[model samples]
Target: MNMHNTSSPVTSKPEELVPSRYALKIGDIDVMVVSDGVLPLPTAMLAHNVDPSARAAWLKEMFLPPDAFDWALNAVVVRSGSQTILVDAGLGFDPDLHLPRAGQLIKRLEAAGIDLSSVTDVVLTHMHMDHVGGLLVDGVKERLRKDLRIHVAAAEVKFWDAPDFSHVSMPPGFPDALRSAAKRFVKEYGSQLRQFDEEHEVAPGVVVRRTGGHTPGHSVVRVASGGDRLMFAGDAVFAVGFEHPEWYNGFEHDPEEAARVRVQLFKELVETKGLLVATHLPFPSVGRVAADGDAFRWVPVFWDY
Candidate 1:
């Protein structure tokens, strides 16, 4: 499909003081990490399965607040050959939740010169509100091309039909919001969905594979070209995941399986030396992985000016 933008009016809002988008290349593919803003959530959400004291100790060691903190929300854009693929849509506005900082994907994308209509394909990591809500934003669908292909795991769609939340540990009202978002997403975009079984290539050198831990059909996108590699590892890995892969995030649907997936992905990154980017990591979260004894280490790349 030929991706082109329909002109939209430039608003009078002032430009942001700090940069919100980081661009890089994996050999031939063009990649841009865009900030959707931040989500101020409880620190306990990081590792609810572990003891509070242990979680507190880690927070202290990291110099973070013990009660709550902002989790960086990020999304990525990839251009390869003739296709422009959005890795995940950021959290759009949710009135019920008081997260005012998040849901900046659409504005950030426009700031980065990416139009909704220009996106040929959208590869969702899962049906989580944060990963697919941007498309649900006001008038977003109207601006998008009618033929826009949304590739999500078939397992994810089926699971949402009758999602299981007994294994999760989210705050009150979150589960309902998540379920509503997923249902609304499928209802609105059902016809455009291109459900994949395991893995599918969204564009040249861009492949998304189901990982199934955070959600039943959670997936990660891998971009490989020439000798370089990078993985947009949805929710499989987090900032704390490097040191304590076993600790379960409150958002995980299956904590045990999520931990296993995290460890496995870390090993793969270490062996292949591919760059890593995740949704909940700090903004512009592009880094590499290293083995720190039995645990893992995050080695962020030095920013290129």
Candidate 2:
């Protein structure tokens, strides 16, 4: 877990807060791990199925604080030839949210010398605010990019679009805001929206596979070229999810389904030895999931690049 330090051009009293971004190669595609910021959640908000005491003990064993966990808001950028594809834009600019560490994705992308308009495709893993928020400009309803095609799970769009569809897993009264966001997203990008039902290819080397349960149509993106392969596992597994695929987060729409998908995806990754780019493992979350007995472990990539 030797995370690389990608510097931020800002200063503070003790030390400068650095924003992280990393680049790696997946066959012919050039992939960049960009950060939006870190989202901290109380440990009490984590486990929905497991006993609280047991979960807390495990956290303590891992040398983590008994109170909170810092989850990274990471997004991926994939470039092949002339095409630039973005996976799950981070939390958009929202001053009201008061999440100081989040909402830095666009700034990090710009700092990396990536042109905002050059992004040709936006492949949304799910319609979570943390993921799709960056699609809109700072506090504005307008889209950040007008020409890029937006791809999302058909099931996801249908689930969020239904008037009667109430999200049970979110905090009380939060579902309304989420539903409104989804509708706004649809209204803004419906003309450019491309929805897929099952495993479908977005580009020559990029494929989206449905791994539902986190959301109705949550997906994992697979990018393959030559003999190299990489999996952009969007919200399928967090760092702890690797060791306890059976234990699901409170936000999981269907905990059982999410666990099932996690186990299956982890096994497949172990068998294939594919590089995993997770959204919430650690900052610049690129790693490999290996079988640890019946469970799994995250062996993060150690490249300095």
Candidate 3:
């Protein structure tokens, strides 16, 4: 994670000018890390139980500003044999949101030479706006490949389809938006929408495991071929999640439960020596976890240029 130098002064860029696509081969599967763009997350909102001084020091050490954190929106595309699986749909084609930094995933995929129509499966890790927004590209309903199948957790679909208004506090119109999106997705996908309970094999080598907490049915997608393994941990943990598994994000459906799940996932990664591909981590968010005392640490794998 500390791949960059801390002595350099970070500059605010109007747009991401670098290439937002990366690819790697895991045995027979081709995994591509695609970036939608970067969003500014307020630091105070995710501080949780971390000490102010310690948080500030960690930000400075990571060469980041203390005020706003750069949260990346990443989606994974796994090509195993004849199956092309897309892990998540990023912030889809939206121009009025004013968040010009995001919503570039569709273009990035095209640049990567990926044919959207060839996508056999679209597996949503969760229905977060950033994650599911890309279900439609350019406002076309059928933009999602003609021969595509969608996989989602039964709990997740049920939770969003009939969200409990009680004990729920969200920005104005957000609840309605969630419900509308969930309904529309179900209706549009129709028989193509497949929901499962705990674990499901979306494809031959890609499996989705339910690890709730961030959302009612949040899950992780594991891609395995031969002996190589990689986990697309969709928001199970973020950049500092490994180091501070107890620090819960304010947006979590259950803060305490999210922390517990984070710890569990970290332990499993450490034991299995698996590669973690986080959605909110920095671009090309591929790394490994290690146990450090009672907590854990993130060690990003070196990428060959």
Best model per TM-score: 1
Task: Give the Cα-based TM-score of candidate 2 against the true structure.
Answer: 0.89
Instruction: List model 1 lDDT by residue over 1-305, tens digit each.
Output: 21123223665874776668888889888898889999998898999988999999999999999999999999999989888999899899999998888999999888778878898999999999999999999999999999999999999999999999999888888999999999999999999999999999888899999999999899999999999999999999989999999999999999999999999999999999999999988878999999999999999999875
Error of 1 at 79 (Å): 0.2
Which of the two, 2 or 3, has more TM-score? Answer: 2
Instruction: Give the per-residue lDDT of model 3 (tens digit) for 123-191.
Output: 998887778877755454555566678888988887876665443334445566666666766766668
How much is 26 displaced in model 3, in angstroms?
1.4
Error of 1 at 156 (Å): 0.2
lDDT of 3 at 48: 53
Root-mean-square deviation of Cα positions for candidate 3 versus the true structure, in angstroms: 6.0
Q: Would you list the rank order by TM-score, best first?
A: 1, 2, 3
What lDDT is obtained when candidate 1 is compared to the true structure?
0.92
Model 1 scores a TM of 0.95
Model 2 lDDT tens row, 159-223: 78673333234444446656666777788778898899987788889988788888888998999
In model 3, which range of ten residues has the least summed lDDT? 1-10
Ranking by lDDT: 1, 2, 3
* Winner by TM-score between candidate 3 and candidate 1: 1
